[model samples]
Structures are given as structure tokens and as C-alpha cells.
Target: MFTPEVPFLRSSATPIPGRYVLVFDSAEQTESTSIGLRARAEEVPQILESEGYSLTEYFPRLGIAVVSSAAEQLDEFQARCASRRMPTRVVPEMVYHALSAVPTPQPTDSFEDTDQATWGLQAVGAVNSEYTGAGIKVAVLDTGFDLAHPDFTGRTVVSKSFVEGEDAQDGHGHGTHCIGTACGPRTLADGRGYGVASGSDIYAGKVLGSDGSGSDATILAGIDWALENECQVISMSLGADVQQVHPPYVTAGRRALELGSLIIAAAGNNAQRSQGNPGFVGAPANSPYVMAVGALDNTLSIADFSARTLPGRGGQVDTSGPGVAIYSSWPGAEKYNTISGTSMATPHVAGIAALLAEATGFRARELWAELVQEAKRLELFSVDVGSGLTQAPPPAEA
Candidate 1:
């Protein structure tokens, strides 16, 4: 009984030591009857336990498990499953990083923050949208958030940490910035607006630690929690540089959409188009079920670092967002900061997704369709910008 390791397109991604992700096919898909499905589900845990693997976490809803074991022990378990024709997939756990890149020099553009809103709000038409994401739950799974940020003073924000030994507080500023872009207050103390879904509930899940890195286990847990909470929109501004679609996210994203939650993720920032290098969309984002977002500058141009779509299924960019020189919230006394990357772009799409959800009562795939249909088609190539810049639905659409 020997099962081959899950194959991925070659890239710099390295698997975590002694950690693996196990995915079980849904009972409905693998078994012909409910009773059979139940029996197989029950037996999965017992089989893992007997195989000398430590079951670190089990997400029954997603049929995903994170396990720790010696390499040989995992091979034996995989072989047993293969011999029994168990429809299970075993992949080495890999680390993902926050998608934010170092801010490059600002482009020559007249769009800047005004008393009404930041450049991003203006670029995406969030300023004129009639709908605020009221009552909609938007989850941002990232490095955490600044609970004490003044702009979030009165907002309803529920937070939890999936990263071990860390609270939901954002030690790194990336998560705070993303949350602000997605669900910050309508008007800050200075009377400037940054967030899009100003009225949406915020669910901040700290999947990445302070060092700005997280393994697949923590990320999957965050997605599971977001799904459990029934969030309509889940924003993930993180990914690895692997060009191939990861199997775990394939299941996670598909199941999320089926459950009425749309997972929006960064398309990755590994490109350097100025140097003639157009990077490909990476894992999680490259999964077909997940909506991949590329980055756009204020001039409505694709950012130099924005990844291009790769050839084949699940490797295309689905949309673009205001990413470069984007202004948003920060932690502690910093209060505010301006940065760039597909990370900044992702929340713009998430916040807009919230608006569409509130406006059209659309969830999951429909919400995704509306967002793409409403995008302001840019002059860039489709491989880079997808349906072009994401736009907020106007009053008429609402």
C-alpha cells in the first residue's frame, strides 16, 4: 500500500517538517448512501489515531485534518488509505505569507486622499455607492487587527486567533490595514473615509503570526471558523508563490462557496513586469473556487508586482482592486499608514463584495458574479487585471 505524494508545480515553496494536511472526500461524494458516509466519517479518526499520527485539528465540515507524524508513519497511513481505496489526499503543510509588498514609489497620479475619502475609495467608486454592508458579516483572515484603533472604536468586531500563542491583536500592521480597508468606520477623526463596507460586521481571525508567516493548518482553521460563523465574505490577503493550485484550498474554497461564503484572495505579488517578469497566480488564489484579485494603481494601471494568470484551469485572475499607494489603518500610535500590494487590493474587493451582498442579497458565487459584472473594465490585459478594477454598485443598482 503506497500512495504517491501530491504533486505541485515547482516553485520555492518548501513543506513544513513533520506536518501534513489530510483531506477526506465528502461522504456524499464518496459514498452512495448516508449510512455509508457516516460510517466512513466515523472511521477516519480511528484510523488516523491507529496510524501513530497526532491529529492536531479536524475540520469535519471541510473534511480536512492537520496531522503531525514522522515521515515514514505518514507514508504508511497513506498506503493504508490507498489499499482501501479511500478517497483521501495527503499534502505536506506549506507556509504562506501576508501578500503585502514593500511600497514602491508612488505613480504620477492626481488621485489623492480628500476630505471625502481616500484614493482607493474614489478609485473603486465606494464613495458614491448607496449601500453600506450593513448587517453583512465579513471575515478577514490575516495577521490579526488593532482592537484599540480609534477608527474602530464603536464598530462591532469579533476576533479570534488560530495562530498558536497569539491573540487576535495585530502585532504586524498588515491585518489592521486590510480590516480597515474592508470594514473601517465611514468617517475617521479627520473626516476622511478609507473603508468600503463601513457598516459591515468585522470578523478578524488571526491566522498569521507576528512574523508574518503561517502554515496551512492555521489558515484552514481560520477558514473553518469563518464558515462556522456564517460569514458571507471571507477576505484572505495571503498566499504562497507556488504556481500550482493547492488541494486543501480547492476543497476549502468550493465548500465555502457552496455554503454561501465567497473567499477572495490576493493573486500574489511575485511579478516584476518592469523587468519583463510576469509572475503566475499562486496557491489558494489560483484555486478555481476562490476569487483571485490582482493589484491596480490609482491611474487604473496594473501594478508592477501584480501576478499574471497562468495557463490552465484555476490559474486565472478573476478581478483587480485599488492596491498601490493605498491608505488605511495601522496599529498603535501610527494610527494610519499607506502601503501597496495585492494585499491592499484584496480587501477592496471584499468590502465591495459586502456592498453587493447587501444590495442584491447575493451570497457566494452570485455575489462574485455581481462584483465581476460591475467592475470598471480597465485597459490592461485580461491576464493581469481579470474583469478589470472592482467597482462598488451605484445607487441605481442598489
Candidate 2:
């Protein structure tokens, strides 16, 4: 077996001791290694222990399968090489039905801009009958939303706020805007543009306070809530400055993925040319499993204020979206608001995922891989731009 001088993990949720992750010298090696999810946290040690391995880190909400950094295990797995992707597949309880494979969009004409119906081309061409977020439940982990918003006409089924002293009301307006971009009713008229996925159900996970800022504990709690709620798509339109990832954020993101939830976060807007350089990709967004997004201009150009990448070759960000003057629904009366940042760009993908999840029925890693594979790779401003824009690929021949 060829050992690459590093530990290995079957999945991101499996906790390993120390601030380390299982690393493969090459993508091919990662393909050679085995990856699986844990069916039950209780049986983790026994399953690995049957192989003389022990668990280091544990994310119960995600239901991860196996986690180890022991060099010998990695070597053994490498010897049993196979496809570019892992062969082993560990599974948790199939709590919810798998998203349907065929495209099944639930179209509506009179609802608010849940499908992002006002942005003209951006919303018009973004969805279709096969691409609406039909059965997927999205957890909007932000400030509380007005469940009575016309855009949210008949969309909300679950809502909980952890912003101590705050009720189910959106004072900051950030969460409402984020939810609208991801999924809302048919309010916009030009070309009938609205949210990218109109059929998706939004769970108002009020973590951020009325001021649009939240604590680490609140964010973590919201993650747990999403997992328990069986939400498939999670969109975080808020972010903090701080180039590196924090342990708490990493744990929460990994946990969300374990629960079969696709995680998306704003890459943050700090540009780094000022004193209060709040441009660094903050917590949760810094997590690997979470798709950290940057921003772009109308012509698919990188946003000037978008956060830049680190000084590493592979550290290039995951993707980018239209962040400049991009418009979407807000918390107030039937209306829309133009916003910027990876925050604005995040819902584009989140909405797209709802559409794709409605089409392909891919789980967390699967959805992420498809998103990247179907993305437009414009690595020009690798730092601030990340992986250019994200949009659906042209329809392939039947």
C-alpha cells in the first residue's frame, strides 16, 4: 500500500482528534480511498473497532459513519483502489424520502416572487417544470420572517427563532431577503421572474438577531434544528470576517452535510484594502463542506468587494454569482430589494439546488459535485472572484 504520510477520514463528519483532516496527496488518491457515512452513531466504534479503528470526532446530527486518521488504515484503503470517487457507502437511517430523480416543478402564477419572478432574465431562465424545488424543504437560518408575506403566501411549514427576545418578526430584513432569493411566491411580473425554486418550503430558522448579527452558539443551534427537521437545502446569506475556519463552524457545517443537507454560505465582502478588513470568509463559510460563494458583476466579472482567496493554489474559492445590484424579495410588503455580496450570490445556487434537487435528487456531496461540475469556471481573480458564476448548463440531447 502506498502511504501518503497523512491520516484519512471516510467522511467530513467523523471527528478526528487534533486540528487535522484526512488528506490525500492527489485527487486520484482520494478516489482510491474509501468513503462512507455512518448509519448509527452508537455503532460507530464497533464498526470501526471491528477493524481496530476508533472515532475521534463525532457529529450526531449528521449521522456520519466512520472517521479515522490512522496512517495504516489509509494505506490499506489505497491498496484497494478503484474509481475516482469513493466506493464504500455508509448510510444513516433513510429518515426522509430521497428527492425525486425526474424534474417536477410545482408552478404557480399568483403567489409572491418565491420563484424570483421580478428579475427578468435572471429569474425567467433560471427555472422550469423539471427544475422547481418541489419536495425539498429548505431551512432559512436567518432572522425571523413574516410568514404572512404575500410572497410566502402558502410556503412556510416550520419556523423557530433563537435570537433571544425576538419573535417571528424580521427586524433586520436580511433573512427575509435571503429566503426570497432562494424561494418565494410569484410577485415579480416581467417574464414572471421570482425565486429560482418556487415549490420549496422555507423553515424560518431565526438565529441572527434583529441587527443581522448572531453568536456562535445561536448558529450552531440552528444547524441542529435543520438536521432534526430533515431540511435538504440550507442557505446562509450572512457571514463574518476572519480568513480561517473556526472549530464550531466546521463542526456545524459537517454535521449539516451528514444530515443530507446541501450547505451554502456567502464568501463575505471584505476586499481587504481597508482597516476594518471584514472581507475574510468567516466561520461556517470557511468550513469545507459548506460551498463558500463570492460575488460577480453583471458581465460575470468579479465583485470589487468580494473576499479574496488565501495564498494557496487549491484554496481558490468554490464559486461566484451576480452580487452587484442583484434584486430579490425582502421582508416588507410585496416588494424586492437589490443587494450585493456572496450573500446575494448564495441564494442563486441555493435556488438552483432546489431546482436540481428536484431534478437529480442528489444528496449533499452529490449535489455539491454536480453544482461544481455544472459551474462556469472563471478563475481570473482567484482570490476575490473564486470560481466565476454558477448557472444551469444547456439542455443536453435526449
Candidate 3:
């Protein structure tokens, strides 16, 4: 009876069938309304099954369900929900990819200074911070991680793979690099550090596959898992190159913040601003509730491929980080490599968020605001770098 109008777009048509997430009012509403809503949700699986749609999973707390169906079925489903005033929404299942690795570098010990390998760590003052993110929990959702990577030998990591039959192992290398930057060891075997919040608990959720691609459903499931684990920080280095916000992600982000978890995403790597063509921020990250991060080079310049914020676009780049030719752990026996993208920039912020979480006990929006406040203000427009490059939190006063 208390159906609020949900803002979600309808799909026309596509060859392959995809998953759609239907959202209803929270199950924590008034008792009568909550009961009614739960009843309606319980009826959903049967209703969809009757209509030839398969229900994938349901989150009773958030009042959301994922179903695999065709566009035509989705249109009919939307109409039915509207008729009943269910206040439901259909989330698009678009393909999103890892934003970096334009040119893969071979693993080498050429860089004598380990700190020199990861310029991002130094850029964010990771060297000075005494806090190693100990006791803090961080979730990095991307390609599977390398379970046998030597650098992570003694670390405590919990991993799960959401990609149908795949295991949570980094065959693509992107997730391993991201984990290395966000929660890798304080000091590598060679004595040079390349991570922030090095001692934080690592949660690796493999949403993307070895091909470095995944759909919205896979990614959303990963978000659900991260929030369920009560991770203080969720780092997403993958996203669809779309200008508009995906409705389910917006809902998921709001729910995560409400539950004291912060989701950070890559702005995207599809821009050519200097060439008179600028790309807009990508989805999930483009959603207002999620923090959208861009890429900055060693010279403090925006990366040519980093997406930009534009007028009328719902999402804007929130902050920046060192993404150009940054070094970190790689998959296989190689051990390490350097790559670039807004994807690379994202983990820098996540690692820093972990440190801030450890220092201030701030959760959700407060944690987000704290990161923005301490960022090093650069002589650049807010659209390029919302509050400039992110900085590590300073030492607490006695």
C-alpha cells in the first residue's frame, strides 16, 4: 500500500538474456507493511517461474531479488509490479570490465626501491602512516585473486568466486594487483613497501572472470557479500562504461552505507578529453551514493584515458589517485607488474579508507567525508578531481 515510485529504466531488447534485480520496500518498515512486503517477495519466485524466468537469489533484508530473463519478459514483469503497486525496479545486467592494463609489463626487479615501484603509496603518504589497517576488514571485488601468490603467503585472506564455475584465484592479474595495493604486506620480501593499510583483513570477491569481464548481477552479488561480512571498505575496480547510474547499485550503496560499509569504484578509462572527446563516468561508480575515483599520473596530471565529469551526467569523478604505470603483485609465477587506469586509482583510495577507518572508527558517509577533507588540494577543477588527490590521515593528537 505504501508504494513509492522507483526510478529505473526499461530495456528494449538484447540477444543474450540477463539478470534483473527487483527492489521492494525494506523489510524493516512498519510491521503490517513489512509482513505484506515479505509475503509479496515470497510470491515472486513462483510468479517469475510461471513466466519462464529463473530466480537467482534474494536478499530479504534489502528486499531485492535477482532473476534471469529476456527483455520482453522484463517489460511484462515491470507492468505486473506496477499494477500491484509493488514499487519494484529492474536493474540492467550490462557487461563491465577491469579499467586498466593497456600495456602489460613483464615482472622484473629492475626498480631497486620497492617504494619506487608503487608511486601511489608515496603519493598518498603511505610511508608515514603507522597504522597498517590492522583489525580493519576490506573487500576487493574484481577478478579472482591468485591463491598461491608468494607475497600473500602468511596473510589471512577470505576469498569467494561469484563467476558461475570459477574459483577465487587471480588468473587475470588485475584483482591481485588491486589487493596488493589495498591490503598487501607492509614490507615486501625485498624490504620495499607497495601497499596501504597493509595489515587489514582481506576479502577477495571474484565478480569478474579470467577474461576480466562480468555482468551487473555478478557484481551486485559481490556487493551483497561484502556488506554481509560487515567490511568497512569495499573496493570495486570494475564498471560498465555508461553515463547513467544503475538503480540496483544506487540501492545497494545506500544499504551498504546504512550498514556502515563504504563502496569505492573506478571512474572509468574511456576518455580522450585532449582529443576533443571526453567520456563520462561509468555506472555503479556513476551512482551518487558510491564514491567515483579518477586517475592521476606521477606529475599530478589527469590520465588521458581517465573518464571525466560532464554537465547533465548524473555521476562525477569524486577524487583522484596515482594510476599511471603503478607497480603491484601479479598472477602466475611472475610475482609483480605495473599497469594503469582509473581501476588502479581505486584501490589507493580503498587502502587509505581502511587507514581512516582504523584511526577514526568512522563508517559510511563520515568515512567518505573524512577522506575528502584530508585530500591534498591540487590546482585542478573539482570535476577532474573532486577534492584532489587523497592523503593518508594524519597522526592522532595526544
Candidate 4:
């Protein structure tokens, strides 16, 4: 309860004004050691209301809350907590943006969409896999999806919008592109296959809004919902460029793992290796309990904009995927588009996770281990690419 000042490194992530995230210590942390901690957790909302703070959202399962209050009230609450063992921490709510990098011109020799499959499908060996992730549930949390897009016709797409007053529809196009990569059709009308886990159930959570930005509250809500539905794999193609490990995601991820769900997130697009800038991985990908994904070009080299690993725990890239000039679905009459980023790389890994789940019957931490063990090790530094580029289980392995 005595809220300590949360130290943060130099970060490019934006903070939402006057909003703070409250993280309660888990039962195991406080129940045996401290008295009345259980009651404190249950009475947090009423206690905050009495202290002049408005509780915006309370996630009981995650032991977290979002609140709006004056600076003086927060200060007073901290003072009161300092006198008593409060077992809660407060940090400023941060805004996370979709991690799509600026589109670079596709190289003339780069792998292209063919009559059979996309270059990403080839890179991950998904095109050759026998498993189609038929019974697996994959959740993609982003800026909604283009539900009306023809590519999703006759597919089981369960969608919901966490962004208030908005429907689960792709307004920014990033989510649709991601969904296309992770769970689109096995074959398009033109006979080209772009998706990896084409037969998996689609759970699209509109965490980010049409503008491609969402606060921690919205994103956490999406995670909670996905966990509630018992999604086997959750894909998040978004992140904030903060160097510190966000505490809330640590709790959410650990609990998700305990529940047999794995959360995969973009490592962040803050680096420009071409300019000698090797950026660090950011939250929530940087959380040890979550998986952080990097981006690779068609030649199997690291992308210039993909973030590198930081010096501490939860800061390393867990794996990588095809992310440059990749072709996938889009909104409206355009129907499809090609883009790049760790954002795009994320779904490639997620789709592969689905295939692996379908192939090996693994979930949570075991699924994470399977992905790293099966990856095609690259010549790149482990700091930049971790275990290596993610690969699908071949027909023999499947």
C-alpha cells in the first residue's frame, strides 16, 4: 500500500493524464505473511471511493484496477498506505500503439505471393505443414477486424470491442492484416494462401481503437476477456516503447500461463539498426511470462526497425517471424495490402503456435517451449533474434 515511486527509463511511450493502474499483490504474496490482506483486496473499490478516486474498471481475476483521481488524493492514499501494509502499487497508465513500421519498398528479389502461398507461409514452413489448427482457438487483439471482408466468409470469427462506443471493425487496417496472416483462408479465389492456421477458430478482440492506440486498461480488458474464453493462443501485434517491465502484464501473463494460454506480443518497432540504433524490447512483450517476437526479412535477416533485447530479465526477444513487405488482408475495396513491422511478425508466430497446438496438443509454457525449440536458428545475434526465426512443424513432425 505504501506506493513507491515507479522508476522508468527513458521511454517514447505516452502516458495518459490523471489515470493510474493499481496492481494488487497476489494472494500468495500477501495472504500468509500479512493480516487482513484478503479483505483489503475485496474492499479496494469502496476504499478508493472514500478517498475521492473514481474506479474506472476492476479486474478481479487479474488483481488489477484502473482509476481516475486527483494528484492530492493519490498522495494521501500513498501516505496512508505507508503507515499500513497496503499491498498495492500504483503506476501511470500508458498508451500503446500498433507496432506497424513504415512500409519500405519491397526488394525486387524478395519472395512474392504465388499461386500457391505467400512468402511468409514459405518462410515458416506453414505451406508444407499437415496440421491446419482445426480445433485450436487463436485470439488476435488489435484494432478490431474487417468482419465483412470476403476472405473471412463462412469462417467462425468471434469478435468484441473493448474500446467504448465502437464495434469490432477494422478502421485502421492493421488488425485485418494480422488476422489475415494468423487465420485467413487456406486459399484465396486467386489460389494464393496467406494465412498459417486457416482452420483455427478466430477470436478477434478490438483492444486498440480505429486510431491504432489503446490504454493499458483497454488492452488488459482484452486479455482478461480472451482468458475468460479460454483461448489457447493470444496474439497481440502492439506495444509501447517503454524500457521498464510493466507489472500488470506480468500478472496477466503468469495467470494466463497458469490457465494454459500463451500471450505473444510484438517486441516493438523502435529500432533503426540501419542508423545504428538498437532499441530495447518494450512492455508487455518484455514481461518474462509473455513471449516477445521480432521481425525478419525474406532473406532470413533481422529487420532494421525491430527492437533488440535489453540488459535485464523480461527484455529479450523470445523469437522472430516474417515481417517485411508481407502480403495479407485489408479493409474495404482494397481487399489486401503488404506491410512491415514486428506487428506483422507477431501473427506469423501466433499462426505457427496454432499449428503447433494442433500438432502436439501443447498449451501455455509448453507451447512456448515448443516454438523456441523448433525455430530455425539464424546467424543473427540472439540479442536481436532470440531462439531464432519461428518455424512451423514439418509434415514429419506434425
Q: Which is superior by lDDT, 1 or 2?
A: 1
What root-mean-square deviation over C-alphas does model 2 reach? 12.7
Candidate 1 TM-score, true structure as reference? 0.92
Q: lDDT at 58 for candidate 4?
A: 81
Mark the regions of model 3 whose C-alpha exceeds 4 Å error after superposition: 1-19, 25-43, 46-52, 101-117, 189-191
Q: Estimate, for each residue in 1-398, the C-alpha lDDT of model 2 and write its tens digit.
A: 10111111001122223222222122222211212322223443454557665454343453333344455564564344323332232211110000001111223442123343443225224644445678988887777676667656656558898767888677766677777777865345543455667778888788777766655445556777888888888887765555445444444566566568887887665563334342455545777668888766655656556666665322346877666555566666656665555667777778777777877889788988877777676747556655556765344358
lDDT (CA) per prediction: 0.85, 0.57, 0.78, 0.85
Q: For model 3, which pairs clash?
A: 144-169, 144-170, 145-169, 145-170, 146-170
lDDT of 3 by residue, 83-201 (tens): 87676777655777777734223235322235433667878888788788888899999997888988788888999999998999877888999999898875765755688888999
Which candidate number has the best lDDT? 1
Kindly report which residue stretches of model 2 are placed more than 4 angstroms away from their true locations once superposed.
1-129, 186-192, 272-279, 312-316, 393-398
After superposition on all CA atoms, what RMSD does each candidate show versus the true structure? 5.5, 12.7, 7.4, 5.6
Q: Best TM-score goes to which candidate? A: 1
